[model samples]
Target: MAGPQRNNHKRPFGNSQKRTFGNSQKRSFGNSRHDQTNKKPKHGRQQMREIKRMGRRHQNEEAKEDFPDFPENDEGYESGDNIGEEPSGAMSLENNPRQAYDALMVLLDNGKDEKKTTKKSEKNTAKVQVIDGNIPGNEDEETEYGIEDIDEDEESVKKEDEEDQNDLSEDEEDEEDDEASSDPFEYHFANPQESILENFEQQVSKDSTLKWQSTKTSTSDKQYMAIGQSAPIEEQLSKGKQNIRLDGNLEQFKIKSRMNIPFDDANITNSQKLILDSVFKYKDVVFPYQHYKDESSIRDLYAAHAVNHIYKTRDRILKNNLKLSTYKEALEQGKASVEDEPELRDQSFNRPKVLILLPTRQACFAVGEKIIEISGLQTVENKKRFYAQYYSDDKVPEYKSNDFKYLFDGNSNDFFCLGMKFTRKTLKFYSAFNQSDIILASPLGLKAILEKKEKNKNNKDFLSSIEVFVVDQANSLQYQNWGNVSYILKHLNTIPENYSEDLDFSRIRMWAINNQFKYLRQNLVFGKFSTPEMNNLIGNKHSLNLSGKVKFKRNFTSDESGIGQIVFKLRQVFNRFECELPVNDPNARFNYFKTNIVPFLKEQSDDKEGGGALVYLPDYSDYLRVKNYLRYETSVNFCSLDEYSSQSKLTKYRDGFAKGKYKVMLYTERLHHYNRFEIKGVRNVVFYKCPSDETYYSEILLRFLGDSMMRDVIKDINLSVVKIMYSKWDANLLEKIVGTQRVPVLCFGSNEIYEFK
Candidate 1:
């Protein structure tokens, strides 16, 4: 029956071919054709069976969305047969059993999701962004499969994180490029030496007023201007830079001043121009003398010559046609006898446009004439004109300090002070006394008159009208017998005794004094030596700190209420020949005389430059000691301070040295102040002891060189300074003498020349 049944199942066409379904695969159509075993290999059937088992096992495990890598059905096999379809031909599976087996393996490698979701129904994929946190839409909100799904999700998240990191790196790179372009540090200076010379050639020298040879460079620290370096004054002024053209009427001449002269019209140096520009801008300025002469220092030039330019220019522009206008106002008000002139209205002040405060009558007269000359108003026709008035304590007749009550209450300006009695002067000065445009008055004159003048309405006439205020040689002013500058500033600002609507109010700058006046805005201060005492006038704690960067030289804070500051750049144009000799030996006295002290003396004595030397000791005891030491030990010949009997002799001695009459001039630093005589032709300024007041030490050195105002009288020879330092104190003082703020000590060798490290 089995055989018949086997026969009943149509035999497969290929021998040894077996086709089965559902546990019936043991039935085999058998034929042993050896060469062609014409039957499916046992291993092929085993591989198919293993694949089926694997499929079953995979079905039991959970399915996930994203897997790493897997094989594809297309790579495995290409079977033309489909499951559950009618058989196309008898099963001849032996033809290609290996390909069939591979297809089954492919099926087992991949699986269907447990909870079937359609392609369209599955969660939407989104672009992953590495925000502060993971993207909200797809990270936590999306549908997920199971445990394996979680693993796949984590891998996908890592890939997204890596991509986000790459994007962030790119953004950081862009930011870095922007920062590199934005913040930069480079430095430059506005005024170089070459630029200054070029400017001089183009503007300063070419101008009609200052027609010199465009400033020639000299090989030495001090420059020599042979007798006729600059063109003759007459030639420079023959064709005046500006023609005087004033309105014929005095009323038109006094048409509310509006100064319009450009800076180009003035004959001044660039440094002076800078100062004038600052003054016009209403800023206070300070000029520091380097304690010695240098090419950069223009303090004296600005003080004496440049200020004149400002005054002259202001007047020339505002009162144009000055040469055209005669004194018609004075003519209308007929002049009478001295007794019949208007009863002296004492203390009456016509607003002085520019106030120049000086220490001595000599300077006042000299500087007053200079201002007039520079104004181009010196001579109507070769005769000096009355431009600025000069008054002094000595020139004013002597008056008992307490006899003011007996004196007539006549206006001081109306009368010339003669023999301690007030008497009206020539009528030509009638308008001058009442109203001079420029005032060059001694501080003592102002101090004495203001003190005794009945403090009525016109007490502060000079100060009230001042537009520009300057104190030339302020060190001299404070050292001599004038009231302290602080007191002057305080008194100037103080409201006058009888200030009222009727009083002639001076024109104050609108920017300085506003409608809702809080304080003066643009009042300016000019000082050659800016002493610490100035702080009291401009507000104490708010004063500039010299220990820090000065007001003008560097970045400094000066936004206080009162005045503006003008600070000059202190520079070294020439190398200082510093001699840093150590004088602190145990045999200090004799060693000093033998090595430096006596040698320096002999060198000055033999120098044929017609220039003498100054020997400065710190105190009287040191002076005497050095004086005796020089005479007894070194045979050095020098003039001592005690030899002078009176001021006249002191003056003679000073002049004689300047004239080369003496080789050596010795004095204590005390005598430098007491015996104040202008000495020039100084070959060497020697220091035996360190200066107690270092600032004043600089002033003493300045005395050796003459100001442009007094240049004609000076020797105009080259200068050298020496110091015989004995101790650490001397070394520190030596540092100050070199005129540097940063380096405390300078290196100098036996050759007596500065060494740069």
Candidate 2:
């Protein structure tokens, strides 16, 4: 007993070994807390919660694919575990500098050597560097002027809490206390991380030096890191509400004859090289996905090298200015702004010089990264330039240039251009027009921004300087919203006259008169399905009336990537269309639904991979009819959007079918309006009705096709495409189903599986 009391397992140097930081199991540094008095960041707790939630959702997705035995109910989803998750991009993100540095700090002890090893300053990421209880940027604060900017009204919750403490009745206070204590999880909707990050976003918004710091209190046995230092801790969130920045020495953008950023040029396909050259030439060229001959991503190739061409143009302009070139020459070249008038010298400096629109938020940022990498912008002395900001649903971090940037220790005179993902919030964010350059927005995002600026009378001559306009997915863009396409076409490259006092034209790179820009932009639209209507959008693309200049419906067909003549063998379901079901006499759709769709789905109901029915109907009414038919007419496990409207519900249904939860997944094409889906690994692809637009022909097939997603997400399979062709309109889809030699094709019709002979 005495020996046990004096055990040799004593704490090292008399320090208790039991003490630990964060979870003993995970052995992370610790859950850190920042200066709450300055701004209560969502750092410690709320972030952990969101992280846990996101992890679970990812797990569920993988489990649904792997285990194939998880329950198919929405119970796990609705329990507040998985909802409102927008994937940032289709590709894996390159490692962020700040993220890598912070991760390194987490593994090291709080020894002074830790700081020395990571002493190099980073431009993009802010690190917490609290010393002697003094926080940077907090010493001058008297009141919370701009700590956080919530989407909610700008009222301060702290002031409200003060008022409550000062004037609330005793009974009211007591009742509030009881209610608060009743639910430990309940708190006001204020996102702690967002509020804390609000000022940081705003300060960093205008490209200020944001130094996020952390204080490490460490002894030999234990180390405690301040929450401020561990902030990525979280990602910038989803790409929708995200921001991006670009800061590099102008001198660094020189030519690297042999340097290629994402991939070497030799691996680049000839079609891709042609598109790249066309982009540089300001030619309106459409390179649809149909022309893809190699496995290489043409999108990456275009964005990477296109950025090089843009930089070349800008470098030429900068050198011209240095060489004392006449303002007229720079204006004629149309590469940058060069205001000669003294009055125009003081104008806003953050308008976009170029514009590119992609299909999603992630694409905007990913392309931006490629541009940055190829430009040799890996390191920079200053971090206060919000060079690139992607605007999405506020998920992507927006590059904000401080309107008060001059007041901060950042560049005030140098003009800045940000790259932002286009989100619905782009309509409301007032600073977008002033700060954006090389805008990367979807057509819908541009529409929202256009409408908001128009309604608010803040048309700041921002688009007048645009030199290039590129739409990456012209065909899919047309399918998503033809009206948005029209809206962009009507105003893009056109100089508007609604002047705003807030706009500082002098800061514009080539600030002449607002209406005096000499360049008519070159437009490049990529359309998978070539059509004359799309060509019209580029009408007079080189014209000054905001109409498109030269347009070419370039469908570069190569035998290697072509869907070969095998697709020509698609057979008509009937020897001819006979009135088998009289329902078509009154409702042609109903007869096809009963005669063609019903039987094919019934046959697939017994497949080992869960013979799930995937019906893509754009209209909600038709979705209901199919869903009802399956429910009442057959014993198939099926569900629909009858009452459920949330994406979580739809996800559950789709995932359930994939994991053997249901036999049918009735998805509406309308879901694309909210957010598109690329469902993978499903066994049967039944086309209830083919789309009128050939643009969507390949898209719809890819969505349900056995293997079109990421290379590793699902295994390749021989697909069985079930076609419902009761009428000629419906029968026309047979050609789309029996595609060319890119892959083998099989179609089920007339109670027979027809192989492309």
Candidate 3:
């Protein structure tokens, strides 16, 4: 550095010297550039102050344009004078790039205007001012400008966006209010406090005298009183003896054909009258009457109730429609106000309010006939087609049992669903379920519809509005498939997935809209006998009817038990097992039967004095397990018959077992229930589990043991033996078989075995 001092001379670009790019002019690059050689460039607060100064200058220029008399060289206009002064309403340049951008645009436009207007001599002056005003030296001002501007722009933009969103939301709310005010039916009302159940009770009480008469005079008696002795006296005086008698009989028949007569006019027994009163009062009833004999009267009572329900429902709907129409007309005529309009709620999800569940097509036909007769319809649409589909002309097979004969008398097809629509003077059969007033279906048929997958959902929507649910001959359903009945009940009175196109939301009852349809539904379950399954269904949570429920009690004495019908004098042994829980009873019973009963059965089969042993299992799963064990695990020669067995296979199994080719015959209760085949050559019977229907036990014994012809053929009456396996869970079955008096002794007794002859 000392050697270099020999060439010491004043440089043209000294710190004190000035330089210009365009012409001879002095220019300054602010304090940042001036102190760049000795000190670090200014940043943060100092730079921000400079930017704010530029913004103030822009504002001053705008003020000058507004007021031409304003001073240009004022203290506010001097950048240095206001360097330490806080900007008036100044936003930080780093936080608000919009202000900085405005400052920049103002500087550029001023420079262009000066260059265009001034002489070339003044061009350098304007250029120097523009460069000195904004340009920074020895620092990355471009990078700083970009970073600060981007951050400030993002924050400012977010604030603006939030403000816009708030404005839009307010506008949307205003529009919604406007729309609501314009439409009268758009507003939804809260659920009403008053229950419709009380209304039903009141109506029933008021109409008791007209609807429920207790008089003994029948419709025939009334007609006879009207005719007096005139008809009979005229018939006796007439010369055409046969024609006159026929005319008299025809008049009597006509009187009987009028089924729309009052309840007292029918030839209903006192017991039936008692049942009908409860039914008419909308009380749930479980009547275990002899269905074959009382079915006619029961059908008439329910049919009348169903028809009356339909009429009342339709009348309410029509009344509401009329009121709404009148209100609309008055409003158009300027005679009424919206406040004066009445509130009416009378509709459900769909039109079908009555469901009659039957066991077979024949039963459905009978219900349809009763409905028509009760409705007093002079015209029936599709009547012939319904008859052709449900009724059969084929000669019925000669069944040995009258119960079977009555059960399977007509078209016994179990899969059927029919819809009936009522008009002013006609009843329309085979209508769409959604358009029908009444639905008649078998459990199996309805279950199929419910389980079916459709492109459009809500296949069970038609069942959503069922108000009166009737299950006639429900005992027969247990033999078919009790699960189907449970499935149908599970889906009843549910909210629909899709509303009907014609549905009036304004007319929907508050209870229905609140999903309380099940509470208002009336259930009528009629059967020959009660089971735990039926009791469980009746006590289900969904069966909570607000009106009330009634279960007809059946008292059984030891003398009335089905066991008395058995003609065989052989000893019947009942073996009991212990289980802590009902769920474990099935497994425990199976194990005990395999360990103790199977060995005894094997020993009995080995004897040459008898044909073979028959083991009966009620549950299909138990049947399958025993079947697999006998076929694979055991060395027993056995033939089996279940619900799924083919006719040919069943015949082969029966013949082989009868001919002593098989040592044991495995029979399922369901098989006997569906086809009560006369199983012969069963010398020894072992009940793996008791049948649900107690009559089945007697039928099984009587068919094989009590048959004198079979006993004579086999000559093994004295060798015959019956063994039944039971547990506490079999109390229902035991009650029906051995009478109610013995149920407790057999179920809870200390002894594990009992014998009867």
Candidate 4:
């Protein structure tokens, strides 16, 4: 085997191989001789390494031919795996060492030449793109690279192709947009609205089939909200007191319940009696369910309903000169009467007519059989004359049929002036003098006549029973002379000029009177049934006095007592009368129950000392229930003075404020003690309680005063001194203003600190 292998090697090298072996042996022999001579080995190891590198390069060339990504004959040094570099040289196997080296250098030069061409092309492309307003990629970068690098050319071409494709896609998008705009909706379509509507309807039908219930109504009837139908006043009252603990502190108030007023305490009036009776009679009955299940709430809806009807009736009566028939009714009656006479062509009954003329609200709303009796009159021409005749009729029974036309031409312009003055005086008397304490109808002369008529009813001689005479003919303002009255009267028979104004002022009296008479045949008078003035009157109106029939009284008892007796008797007679009081629903949940005590609690405070400062106001439903209960109790007892005697007092003080005594001592002491409280528009000092946290305390105090809505109505009210404890004072600087009151500072550790008056 050795002979064969040697022979093979010898065949390849021939005599040169043998000479090389012989030379290697001779060199070995010489090296051995030199070793003995101790000569140092020549430094040819690096040269040997270079020769081995050349051999590797040659082998790499053959490998390159089989690989596509690798270049074959570019340079002696192979290109690394890094991007963008040319090979330095190419290597070959068959050649003299020097010749091959020279060939490799030539290859390196060609690669260098090619790399420059590629770099210049890339620069030109970048410059061209930048000039065209496109972002240049690697335009400013010149990576340090060998000139002989050839591998970078392939990588550059590949990267450039990818960039070009991306740019083309972006450019193509712009072209597509232009094409679409030119072609419009050539490739798009939309369905018609009718189809969309049909779909919508289908969806709606699938979801819910019920139609929306109408919330609008043109009738004068009262409508109840669903929640109100089952809510009982008694149940609500019980709920109100259920949470009230006997040990809890009560809130102080300037105004107290009207029921707290004493009946025999001397300030009572016929109007007050009527109001009290009406309120009480219906108090327990406010919740119809209390008496009868499944009863309609329309009867007790808004408290204003009855008042509005009264106004409407008055308007109609005023407009029609006390005529009972409404315009429509008169027209129909005229047409029916004329049916017997074929040639009658007349629209004469179309004019508006008045049925009743009332000087005051209480007189119109008088709850008595007499009011009904008086209201039943069908026709009373010249309202003032009629009233005069009616009053005079008590003196002489013959005047029952007395025509008012004979005494005063029925059109005396002087009557208008007198009436105007009388109305103004009466209003002033009630508003400025009465101080809203007593009813306004018990003192009037009309009530006296009614009383006399009643007392004389059983007497054999009716003529002798007429004790009072019509001494004065108090006139009212004429139809045209009075600006305010005329303005209201003219519009009484028609709708208001504007809805917003209707929310404030009542309509002209004429329309109300006419409507009352026009709807006389109806269960409720038509004129009294509807009108813009009536709308507001029934909506949110405040009352000051009674109607013309009832009168206010100052004396508790009197010998003549005719007027007071008449009012009292009338109220007794009509105590069963019921009407709705329409009011806006309050913004709180109304719960009703008959529990022994209230049990609801919002939350408890963590602060031990200051926690007691917090309080909760009753809900509107609770308020209503409590009010009704109190009113009921008052009504049943006829608002007796004893009712309000001990626990609380609702005494009427005076119409206007009394003048201060202006005592020098008071000015120095008690008066000076007044820090700065405002009462009835005067600034006075008052000791006040303060809160722990002044900011939170103020917020809570403001709530007690009332909300913004309440404040709007209570315009004249102003606060000066709030009860404040002296203890919570954090700053000693405050002592300068408060003086030597020995107020508790923050160091005292009191519960609350309040503003001092």
Each candidate structure's TM-score, on Cα atoms with residue i matched to residue i, is 0.34, 0.43, 0.64, 0.16
Q: Judging by lDDT against the true structure, name the best candidate.
A: 3
List CA RMSD, all candidates: 46.6, 24.4, 36.6, 50.9
Cand. 2 Cα-lDDT: 0.36
Q: For residues 536-558, write the lDDT of model 4, one tens digit per residue.
A: 22111211001001111111122
Better of 1 and 4 by TM-score: 1
* RMSD, candidate 3, Å: 36.6
Q: Which ranking of candidates, highest lDDT first?
A: 3, 2, 1, 4
Candidate that would win on TM-score: 3
Per-residue alpha-carbon lDDT of candidate 3 for residues 1-757, written as tens digits (9 for 90 to 100): 0001111111101122121211111233343323333643233323322432233334446544433433343321222221112111101121122233333343333334443444554545323322232333312222111111101122332343354344444543322221131121111111222434445345444663222211121222121101001111111212221120101211121121224843553466544554554455455667666336767777877787788667555544544555677899999999999898888877778878899888876778788887887888797865655665566533234644556667755665565567787654457665556667898987756765575444437567889988889888887776665667878988998898887465778778877876766545778888777666665554535464443455554545566566776765777888889988999987998899889887886786576654778898887678778899888977787898764443445656777776778878998875665456667677778888777666677888887665433556347566567888888987867776777778899899989988888
lDDT of 1 at 219: 15
Worst 10 residues of 4 by lDDT: 663-672
Model 4 — TM-score against the truth? 0.16
Candidate achieving higher lDDT, 2 or 3: 3
What is the clash count for each candidate, in the order shown?
14, 68, 0, 89
lDDT of 2 by residue, 1-757 (tens): 0001111111111001111111111112221322222553223222222111123233344434422433243332232112234321111000111111222222122222224433233211122211011333332221101111111111222233234333333322221211231121111110113343443334444653334333222222221111112112133323211111011111222333422456544555444544443343333444444432321356565565355444433333233333343455666788546554222121222245566665443344345556545545433211111121222222211221121111111111101122331111111111234334356556544544454312334443456556556666554454344555566666654555565444544344332343322222455666444444455544433222111123322222222222232232222222123453544522666565677677766666665553455665644456666677788888766655321233455456556665666766676553432234455445444544544334344454454453422433233333445343334333323333333221122222343333332
The models' CA-based lDDT, in order, is 0.33, 0.36, 0.57, 0.20
